[model samples]
Target: MSERTVIPFGPQHPVLPEPIHLDLVMEDERVVQAIPQLGFIHRGLERLVKTRDYMHFVYVTERICGICSFGHSYGYSQTIERLMGIEVPMRAEYLRVIWFELSRIHSHLLWMGLAADSFGYENLFYQCWRLRERVLDIFEKTTGGRVILSACNVGGVNYDIDNSELAGISQIIQKLKRDAKPLIKALVKDRSIKDRLVGSGYLSQEDAVKLSIVGPFARASGVEEDIRMFGVGGYGELAEFKPQTSTQGDNYARVAVRCNELLQSCDIICEMIDKIPDGPICEKPKGNPPEAQGIGRVEQPRGEVVYYVKGNGTRFLERFRIRTPTSQNVAGMVQLLQGCELSEVPLNILTIDPCISCTER
Candidate 1:
């Protein structure tokens, strides 16, 4: 029966990386409702798809989000390849899986650091990002670029890895695993961190599925939906692959999934090197053909990144649509943000790893 108080959360906040203005209606410092205002950085990527050729737009899509750049490029390539009715080489499929998983590891690491920073665990934040820098080095050495490394093509990967490099990668992963395991222990078992995280912003499995959550959000809540397990993007050919599931849908549970996935990605990459067949990395024949409508979906670091491309058998695409994970997860965030204390809002938002740029794109 009491009147509520209103507070403006962002557009410029230390915790939020992008300008996502949220008007929070509060009652006694508890959020009663949240209204999200977006479009601060909407670059009209959907429109650009009409102007740019399918090949060139790969870079554009990669810019959708710095963290999940590989996922965007991979998804776009998959969509175009599907529309063209082209079959990727077996080796290509395995390599794609490897690259995709490695990308996942780095993203999870980056998110972990942000989550730590949000909760005021600055020390943990620095340590996690320091480890992530190693993964970046690996990416630079393998793909020859850092963040938005365009590693995938329409039919296959852009770069190839030789036997010597494969061996080196395996050794590097083994070393990182040792370094990462201890860090994970400190995060999970550290009493101070868990007190701030474990019980806050809880989401039941039913709520997660009902909200149409994707990637780690759904899986962390016990839903077993994964694009890789569906065997769509060369994951089918991989000898080892599995969907990580959990019953607890709290921030702690999400962190566990991400930590384990880091190891899993390293494992997948090492395994692929064993069976990496000898052949071309890509399968672009005589000339790049005209565009056709292609639907490609991949598991981004945050969640699912789907690409819809319509081509008119020309160099440029007729229409391109992308449904980013953050856009889809915002609904879930509204629920998670509600009924929580004002202090916990930043942690909750970081837990979802909100990429406002991707959502607005």
Candidate 2:
């Protein structure tokens, strides 16, 4: 019998941008079990609801995750708006979808770069990020911030784009689609990329459902559960929207699912621009929120993010709660970690595309 050995990985690993520590129990070179740990970066941001007023809390929510910053802000604002019975304008709703899809595209690009780096494909990593910078430029042009956009508010959006600007944005997206094709081809068809990702970290469809996985991770496992179909924002107008999924449930499937969604995001963005209504961008709230509670859900780049707000008819909210995608997907990550070679541990964890800051929040 082989002697069991324990190895501590990360919280400061080179491949992972955020800190996540996993204690791997190994039998020789094979990982027998993975014990995940947290709290290295917890900031108790959730508890800030007690101090920050409901209106100012949107900024705090945006800081939860840089990659999903707008999603968090939108979710929180939506919750407050619902509680206050404030209806956002039609144009604002369409604008929300436009920026949200742009955020998704950039996030997927960032993850693709990181995934490439995890497998030691340095050139591929650079290429992926070089393409991602264009997405960031779009964010800067529209929202005035690259990562954390404060444009989304309780009643509607803080910014607006003219029809001509929206058209220009569409043209830019078309160019991005054309420019990004070569890198996408390299990632999908390159022999070495497939060799590393094809069969690694296999998550069965049944296992994914049992674990309550979300986002591309669940989609990759053939469980169709995209919250966008709920028509929370401008998605109701996007009748042609379809959730991307694959049956393989391996690392490759996850990558493919995200890549396909990137294309879908581009389409969604263009559609939103074309169909956006011309009107007031925001509605002024009438009064303070009454004593009530509401929940807001948005399909983030990661997955479904739930924001719960309880109002006491005061400036400060009585309670605020957030259910981030990474928090829900951790169980699935642990399940995939076990029974893989020790060397494959990082790649398996990376497949989940974890944002520890969001999880630890």
Candidate 3:
């Protein structure tokens, strides 16, 4: 029998955008088991609830992850709204959904670029990000912030897009959809790219269920679990919506699932823009939440994110907790790494789209 070796796979590496360390147990060139080491970027943001008022805490939640900032704020605000029994206007709900979908498109494009870069496709990487800039420009035009848009509040949104601007946004969405097709085709159909991703890290459906994987990672494994199916908020108002899935449960399936979602999000945004009603955006929430617990769930770009808030009948919340998608998907990531070649480890980790900052927070 060959002697076993241990290798450390970085809190710092060229491919990893954030800090995450893994200790890989190896036999020859194959990984036998992979151990994850977290907390490199922990900020203790959850504990800030006591100091910041419940209303102001929306900003804190938004800071948890820049890529999923809108989802975080949306979930936190929904939790506080539920806790206080405040009814947000239907128009506001539709607006929130529009921005949330836009954020999803922005996030998936960013990940696609990174995935392209990992495979040494420099030109493809640049093209992915160039399409993403138009999404950011839409955010800046409407919300006045690109990365951290302070649009969501306790009761509703802070701003509204007029009908004229909404039409312009729809035109931009259509243009983006047309521009992204050939790039996506190249990433999915190119022989060299598929060889690197197709069967590199195989996770069967049974294993995915056993690991409790969430978000696009879980959907890619044939799991039909999505928070939006419950018809929470504006999702119920859509004419039709379904969770995208693939049975392959490999690295390529994950890429395909996210690619499909990018188009789905654009469709959802256009639908909301067409149907949004004209009404007051903000509901002007009054008084503090009664002593009770509130839970909010949103389908973030990575997967499902849950927020738990405890109110003390005061301006200050008793407790605030977030269950980020990355935290839940980490187990499945480790599972995928097992039996993979050492050379394939980085790409396996990237496929899960691990958000270390969100997980650490």
Candidate 4:
């Protein structure tokens, strides 16, 4: 019989992008169980709603997570728009989708870089991030911010991309798609990469449903769940939309799902640019919201993010809350960790793409 041992796996590890602590119960090299500990970096951002006016709170929301920054702002703005009865122009909605999908591409590339690094593929990691830089460049040229884009406002977007620039952006996205093909192929199809990822952390489709996972994590487990399917805002304008999915429910499936979404996001961006209408981008919402509650949901790169706002018929909101994807996916992450080999622990945790800052916020 092997002796049981308890091992602390984080709060500071080489492979982890954020601080997340997990105590692993080990029987030899196998993990019997994993218990997660959070709250190491809570910023109390939600509580700030009482002090910050509803109009300015969008900035705070964008700071919730750097990678998902635009999505946070977009979701918050949608909730406020719904609450205040603001009618954003169709052009703005289309612009919002373009930026949102670009952010998705940026985020998925970032995750792929991190995954490559975890696989000890240094060159591949650099290549992935290098491709991500072009997306950031587009954001900087259009929105004036990279990580924390304050482009979204209460009624509509703050900036607009002209038709010519949109065409150029489409070209860049096409180029990115071509450049990224080989890197994605190497990461997904390489025998060595598959050996490390395939069947490493199996989360059955039944278990995924029982756990209620969201975003690519759930999609990887064959759950066809995506908030975008509701056809809200720019998504509604699209001719077609489908959630990328896989039934393998393992580390490899998670990687493949995200990689495919990267290409899908590029396609969505090009389609929006081609069909985008012309109109005023900002609607300049008037007056404060009534005493009511508003909820907004967005399909972020990691998963589904929900924002709740309670307006008190004043500039300041009565209450604000956010349910980030990491918080929702943590349970599923712990479920995957069980019985995995210790060497595979970091990869399993990375597969969920846990953002501790977003969870703690």
In model 4, the clashing pairs are none
Q: List the residue pairs that clash in candidate 2.
A: none
lDDT (C-alpha, whole model) for all candidates: 0.83, 0.89, 0.92, 0.93
Each prediction's TM-score versus the true structure = 0.95, 0.98, 0.99, 0.99
User: Each candidate: how many clashes?
Assistant: 2, 0, 1, 0
Instruction: Pick the winner on TM-score between candidates 1 and 3.
Output: 3
Residues 1-361, candidate 2: write the lDDT tens digits.
7999999998898877999899999999988888989888899898999899777888999999899998898888888888898889999999999998999999999999999999999998999899899989988998899998998988899999989999999999998888778888888889999998999899999998998899999999999999898787678889686899999999999989998999899989989998999999998777666798898888888887888888888788888888888998999999998899887888888889998898888
Please write out the lDDT profile of model 1 over residues 1-361, one tens digit for every residue.
5789999999899988788999999998799999999989998987998778778888898888888888888888888887877788877787777777778888888888888888778988898888888889888998899997888877788888887987888888788888888788977888888998888888888898888899887788888888777777567667756888788888888888888778888787777777777887788733444545677788887888888878787778888898988887899889999999999898888787888988888
Candidate 1: residue pairs that collide? 290-313, 291-311
lDDT tens digits, residue span 33-96, model 4: 9999998999999999999988899999999889999999999999999998899999999999
Q: Any runs in candidate 4 off by more than 4 Å, and if so which? A: none
| Winner by lDDT between candidate 2 and candidate 1 | 2
Where is the poorest 10-residue window by lDDT in model 4?
Answer: 146-155
lDDT of 3: 0.92
Instruction: Superpose all Cα atoms of candidate 3 onto the true structure and report the RMSD in Å to 1 decimal.
Output: 0.7
TM-score winner, 1 or 2: 2
| C-alpha lDDT of residue 149 in model 2 | 92
RMSD of each: 1.6, 1.0, 0.7, 0.8
